[model samples]
Target: MTKFIIALAYKLETSIKYKRFKEFTYNLLENNSYPYKKHFDTAMIFLVLSTIGILIFEVNHKNLRILNDYELFAVIIFVIEYIGRLWISSDMHKIILDDYEKYQLLNKKYKITKSIKKIISKKVDFILSPMAIVDLLAILPYYRPLRLLRILLIFRLFKILRYANSLKEFLQVFKERKFELFTLGLLYITVVFFSSTVIFLYEGPEGVNPNIVDFFDAVYWSIITISTVGYGDVTPITIEGKLVTLVLVVSSFLVIAFGTSIITTGLSDRMEIIKENRVQSETSKMQDFVIVCGFGMMGRYFCEELLSIGKKFIIIDNDKEIVNSAKSLNYLAIHSDATNMQTLEMMGINKGANSVVALTNDDAVNLSIVLSARAINENIKIISRVNNGNSRKKFDIAGVNQTIIFNDVAAFVASEYLGQPVAFEAIDGILLNKDFDVIIDEVEILDNSKILGKDINLVDFKNYNLTLLGIINLSNMNNFIFNPTNINYTVQKDDILIIIGFKASISQLKSDLINLDFRV
Candidate 1:
């Protein structure tokens, strides 16, 4: 009894370990993370392609030893993968657990034997699943004693469909329109069968027509006429045969048109669903991504800058034309109202979004969007574009983290250019010049950063080829000390450090700061 108990405990502990292993394996196989999962997936893709190539070569050169060796190697890998999947089938454990709970509830007793049986039954069910069966069949060809089983190797190609997003979408389209497609297929078969029978009866051996000597000839002629190919290899020489041919040729166009219409409509609908699914998948995988709540001129400029900097973002616009324009530029865009809470939720603002920018050109709409976004995610950073000076206070009151006054900024630029043309031009050249090697950006200090309690002089910004501009203290939101005279000023938590440097230098500085545990 002690030995049995110890064995059971060990098995349970191993099962728990297997569950964790399954999760890790799933992430490695399915997720798009670089090097780890990506390397595995690439290797698997190469193996699959190699197997297919071997199969093709085997068909042409029947007894190639190299082909057999490659096939054996691929089959071994597939068999190992299949076994790993089965061993980590956590769903089977869930099924067994659920069944055991139900049994205890019904009988008011704990039966180890019954629970074990239930587990075995679930395992059997898993083995018989469609994918599992495919995995098993994919390996059967290696057992060459069954010569007929070699054909089952072709099914290995079907396994690739599991990893293909577009193929899955196509399969979904077919599934959704199966009934319509089935009806059209039936109609086509009926038309072909009836037309062939009538043509054969009218132009067969007893008939006046000599060209169509058999039923198959009449069938072939009907197919050709229906498709409007009109090979003209066989033609009716009698009035009855000609009349039947005319009716079939005319109805064939109608059938073809109807079928085309159904397919076109179904495909359009399925494509839309696929696009939405793709968007959702992308958004789900994103963390710390920006959300641009309009795709106007200002929004477009922001997206362009973000893209140049390699930042991930999604654009939401009410105008379909603007959304399409954004999409044309390869931006992830959704045609929806920026102020709607449901729209923000669908955009995953509460989940993985780092910031939300409202640039709708309407102060009221921007305010609403800011408020809505804050309600959904209190911690999310909110930035809005304010056209009117009066709306700036309203936006601040609505919890907007930042507001850009375009009119004021434009006026200031104009006045600065007029008063000090050379200085203004030099500044503009540095700020607006995309070709400039160095640029300025802000990096926020986190509470846990090593530089938090240290003075500015302690850290060597010059070492990284970065020039210290100033620091904006978050504690006093409006306090920005530019080019501070004091070199011993202590860096505080949540301080935004403004630094200017070359791209590589800035990247190195950012990495160093992040390594020291800076927030942004």
Candidate 2:
């Protein structure tokens, strides 16, 4: 019984360890798993590039012992990464659970052994997958006999294909135009063969010309003439051979031009499609992510605030240059009209979006976006930035939840700065201080929260180093109780708690308030 207990404890420990390991691997490797994935991918890219550089140096400097050592170090890192990935292959726990279920159907005596074998088989299948095969080849150079297989190490560079969206799009272009590319290949080959044969027939020893001796020489001369790389060494002495060369040269140019045009057109179309698909896929995976239409100064500032609060968001703008600028800063942005319903649908505004913020300089454009977003997602919160006060009524009529008037806000801020300089600076210090650890944020109390039915005065916010600034009752919409002295006030579901504290403490409190057992 003691032995059985120890075995059970060991199994529980291993299961916990496996869960942690899987989570870490998923965040490091999977897109949308974490916010810092770009940094991780960039670091891996540099590491791979360094390994490739070392391999190139090793090829030229055979006697350099340090190069060999560097290569070994790279190989060790690759091996560890490969092993970790294999251990946490997709649906690892599911596979084990499936095996356990099958074992339960068998005789009780053979359950443990059969379950073990089944689990091993599933893992072996994962190891034999195409990606796993490449990973194995990447580390095979460690073996003495397979040291020559180090040349295959170059293929390891292709591993980056998984991380690079552009490379994936390039490959997709080729895949989509495979038939056209094949036809082009066949045409080029046929032309080269026919030209080589005809040139040999016209300029061979039996012919009128004696310059070309063999079929290979004729073929070499044909290639040079057609490619416009005339060497003049194996020139056609006969008029017939020269005429044939001219025809081949012209045909080659036509074929080359045709092929180039086809590839260019195909790639352009495929790239656009890939970009759309990528945006759709990323947005679909996100829940409660904000959609910022018009990547102008206001939209940019909103994105900065959202990112500071660790929120996911996508920026949309009709200007390609602005879209590119946002992408340069690692923000997921697309160049497209926000006012169009099709564009809104493509951006997943009707799906997992928490809210839509229209911040275009043009009030008309922002109003159109607000209307379209509300039409698509009736429940989605629509916020519009208005330059004109008259636009606020139109936005409200279109079901916009809020409207920010730039002129009025600017005027208010300026007035406050002039009248209450000290108070303005104090608030600004908390809101804009670069090194300040604390800031004010709002957290909604969900129905399942432990403190939902409790009184505000009973809860010890000071224990968490957080101070309650106010609470906004969503049921009564505009009702806000700021620094309430009422000890009998009870917290209700969907009550927005405006709190000020360190970012970490605020995040923890928010997590506690919305403690729903859910998975991403």
Candidate 3:
């Protein structure tokens, strides 16, 4: 039953829709695996059920006497949760593993327990602190009627949500735009205070309710008029008050509009800075990275594949705004034309990079980049994207290791629509290289082989799915024999066979055909 309850709790935490809720539950579970998450989950269930039971009791007031016992039960459950937190906190020595480091090598039992204590002790305060206060408040019912405030106990849910990315973004916006928001808030306060004070002084003597005759009323009126939400409960009846109201209303509108424009502009600039920082930071940390010349649809897919394999790369585009947008996601991007020699240098082409993938939409620009990169580092591999078949030959000669023809791919896709699966297969075979597997192996003839004098065909090839394409005879000083017929093929000691087949079948065939006597 305990195990079942634990499974249900794990599912609830992991499967929660709210990112904040999920993060909260995950942290709680990770931090205090022994009992913290279980205790919290149990406590919450009890609180929710008790609150609902109380509400039902309130609805049927005549039967409130019957439900009187639940109030104490609810309080007891909360107190137990609170005590459990304290007890778990006190067991700090058991949870921490670091204390073991302080002991001498021979004292294994002492060190282990000490480490456990240290880990638990360090985290105890974090688990018990604000949450304990919330737990305490949740169960304290001052009055049966005032039990509605117990609903505010649900605000504890905010603690979990506060760690969410959305909340972090919200907090970050305020942190980044602190001065601007602070200035706006100050102005709003001043407008409210002054307008309310004037109206209070002006409207007080005219028999308008003195209790509502303060600066707050005038401030309320100002907000309503400025926002155009005029609730109409309060009004400036006196001539002096009316004059003040007129000035306040017009000035308030102007201030609001001006403030909004300033704030919006400030936020946009901050966001841009954030994006640029993201890109620079992301790129600066990458090593042996591929520098992609564009971030178009094809370039994006290429980047995604590199990222999937955990390979590092950076993007370069001509648009500053586009580059900055990529930066905000913490992706490395440079805003520059790929064809420029200076742009290539700036991307560290001369050092610290393995390859460059030119993906510009412009064919001529991509060709120029390939030529420029080859001149900079002839050893650097260049993959150039070509839009048409006409440019493939020229790009290949310009030292482009691979040239992708976008049009050819598009033609194949179009052929698929026309019901040509063979064309699709051919396209896939060319692009993905799916037809055959290339295996490079150094095979040495063993003394136990049966076909020492016999031709190569005497060795069974069909059973192993093997095809011997060539041989390198070390005895004749590393001469390569390509497609040698069975009569010419003679098994010699230390002969290396280069073969191709399906990868698995090739492994089995190699094992059957050759055995290494010794490996250096």
Candidate 4:
């Protein structure tokens, strides 16, 4: 039974792209980027307000025609949003796009179209899954008026929230410690059942609401009280019944506390394992990725830099808590000592990394990573973070690519903050933290844009207050001309301009490019 619960949680989390959907939702909240950002926010707000409004209408004597209408509108919008989410889900190709290419890989050797069809055709179970049943019930069109049953629709939020990393961790822990939870749950049930049976026999005839003529009513009241929810609709009038109720209430609290503790410990352990597995899986598939061996303040800065430039990287750390934290931020991270060769290999360090940044506070651990990496793949670039500036040359002699002394970098940047305002601000915003006013936009030149025929130098970028960081083309996405001196390169259609500027400025630039006159 515990295994079943854990399996369900696993399917909802690791098997689905729930994490990405949360990110997509967050990205949707960004000021500019996607098409449906504003509409999405509007729908969310409407849903919240509508739910509260209708719930009040149901409970109190509030006039609810306007509220009902709004709730209906919100539900309709939510249906559309839900469908869109399903379509955009990672397995969406299987759900809707039934094309041969859907099953075909980049390499033709791994074709599983036949296997996929066979599995889909042979499906037997339909009504067993609670979530599947919930999805079916939510769209059944039977709950037009506000009903208690309709409130179950709120469970749809879990369909989305289950994908979130923190939620996923909770689910994982619940599963890993299901057996203990189940045992405690059984004990709770026994206590409730025994108490209810005794109450029904002892004092049911004397209560005001003696609906406990049968065993079921006694059981229901016991469940309600044990769950710490006394609705006041049912109560005991007899002294014997009231005494039993008091004991049940106190025992319920103790049972709940015990169960919570068990779940917390189970979740912590399972979360660490899940986090490690997630990082390893992601890193295994990544190519030309950077391996960051630590998640300290410095490692976070390094990650933000890579994220700004849209580089692939995985973080490795010995601290399980830090690794889990990184995982929650949607970063791939392994909770293992970076000095270990096995940990490095598991992270695909030997096979796919373009570079490895050893940034753990301990100089010995960082050097060990450099030495181990050198042994595994001498060609792989190693950037070691040095605590003591004097150990820089030793790491250099040990084949480390670059030794960064963080204190010196911080001091230099701090000093420059006074002398060079723009450069310092830009550096601080893009490097130190992710919550900043800067964005990296990759704009493609359309055939109709006026800049297409003009030379890069003559584009009047000075008036626009923008800078061209690099140019990328159809052939290569990574290779870019960074700080190119020559500006005579003619822009063409489909050429990608990797530019960094204030988001508003870039948005205006894109709008201006779209409005440019062209005769073709």
- Regions more than 4 Å wrong, model 4: 1-132, 142-153, 156-165, 204-212, 224-250, 266-316, 319-355, 359-381, 385-520
TM-score of each: 0.68, 0.58, 0.41, 0.44
lDDT of 4 by residue, 1-520 (tens): 4345334544655644876765675556432223365466555655655565566567757656886676677667556655554433334223322333343444343334554454344332323345445544555433656555666656555444323445656776666777887899799989988889878887566544566777788988899999988887767777888999989988998999998889778876775666566556567668899999999989997898788767999888889789878878888777788888888877777677989999899999888999998888889988989999998888998899788997898788778987999988766677456576677778888877777766666555555666778888655554577654365576667878887777777777777777762222
Q: Candidate 3, overall lDDT? A: 0.66
Clash counts for the predictions, in order: 0, 0, 12, 2
Tens digits of per-residue lDDT, candidate 1, 362-408, equal 98899999999999999999999999988899999899999999899
Cα displacement (angstroms), candidate 2, residue 449, comes to: 2.4
What are the lDDT scores of the predictions, listed in order?
0.80, 0.79, 0.66, 0.71
In terms of lDDT, the best-performing candidate is 1
Candidate 2 clashes between residue pairs 3 or more apart in a chain or in different chains: none
Give one digit per residue, the lDDT tens place, for model 3 in 1-520.
Answer: 4345334434544553744643454556333322255466555565555666666557657646546666566667557655545544433322332233334355754434344455565566655566555555565543446746656545444434222323434456666677877888888778777877777877865467553566566667778876767777877777887888788878778778877787677667566545544454445445699989988889878987677546788788887877766667666787778788877765667766789999978899899999999998999989989997898999988999988999898887887858977877765574456344544444566666545555776666565666677888878978998866445688787776676556677666556554532111
The best candidate by TM-score is: 1
TM-score for predicted model 2 compared with the true structure: 0.58
* TM-score, cand. 3 vs. native: 0.41
Q: The CA-based lDDT of model 1 is what?
A: 0.80
Better of 1 and 2 by TM-score: 1
**Residue 471, candidate 1: C-alpha displacement in angstroms:** 2.0
**Which residue runs does candidate 2 get wrong by more than 4 Å?**
1-201, 204-258, 261-272, 508-520
The candidate 1 region of ten consecutive residues with least summed lDDT is 29-38
What is the per-residue lDDT of model 2 for residues 405-438, given as tens digits with 9 covering 90 to 100? 9999999999999999999999899888868988
